[model samples]
Target: MNKISKRPRTTLEQKIMILNHHHKSQNSQAETVNHFKTKYSISTSSFSEWLKDEQNLRSLYNNSNEFLRNSKRKLNFKYDKINKEMDKIVQSALQENQVINEPMLRQHWCKLVSIYGVQDPKRISSFSHGWLTQFKKRNGISKNKKPIELVENDYDLFDSN
Candidate 1:
């Protein structure tokens, strides 16, 4: 009896690379399949699936930054509609160059989730710290450099010579 090997999980970067090479490679189809099979341990069927899913991969890559590119798993937003609304609010704030810290994000998220749970009084949901981190990555939100406050009046209190 032969034991079956587990299929290798492809990262987002790996998927994009494979798709790009598939389009640009001068080699024949079989050769391209062989190359991916050898390097990524991905089967021909999986490669075909990636080719079909090229657009989605491209969209994911375009929306994400370098920090999130190499991740092996893609996180799907559980509360899709709620998340979209929250994302819009966050995006507007970011476009205005406003500083959105963790607390502010949490407050918004909590309020959004609460609003969604209105029909079911007992239904409750809250975003986790991990979710917040991933949310920032998904939306390309980052901390701006801290600005120092300037004093209005200087050297007035010091009278010693």
Candidate 2:
């Protein structure tokens, strides 16, 4: 004859502490669940269900370590929004300039980057080049802006005008 054994229930605080500890230790959820089951003599599936039921645990599991339960700190940087604003700036510069030539685009791109305080020269060059390439493709404009005869067959696309 087999006897059913009663397992002691883990408190919410204990579960949260276990979750937090495993999270800080950079263990995967599966690993954490397995470790807890072994250490506490509990069932992994039940623990997983409890984590989903608790709002804080749900948030913690979904958001990783960036979330703080008590603090209202904003984690996003203004620079992360640079691309959208820069695209607008580029579009406006193209409209104002009346022609989306490489030199003009580069100038406006650099100016926008300066305004945005993105000071790296290499990054400025890269962003300008990439955006210009996409802009050219989107607008269906040829990089060959000069008179066909005067244009060199292989003029470097991003070379200063």
- Top candidate when judged by lDDT against the true structure: 1
lDDT of 2 at 24: 88
Assess candidate 1 and give its TM-score to the true structure: 0.65
Q: For candidate 1, what is the lDDT?
A: 0.66
Backbone clash count for every predicted candidate, in the order shown: 0, 0
Q: Rate residue 92 of model 1 by lDDT.
A: 70
Task: Give Cα distance to truth, residue 41, candidate 2, Å.
Answer: 43
Tally clashes: model 1.
0
Off by over 4 Å in 2: 1-97, 125-128, 143-161
Q: Rate the local accuracy (lDDT) of all candidates.
A: 0.66, 0.53
Error of 1 at 154 (Å): 28
Encode model 1's per-residue lDDT on 109-136: one tens digit a residue: 6677777764443324446667767777
On residues 104-127, what C-alpha lDDT tens digit does candidate 2 reach at each position?
455556766777778786756545
Error of 1 at 98 (Å): 1.2
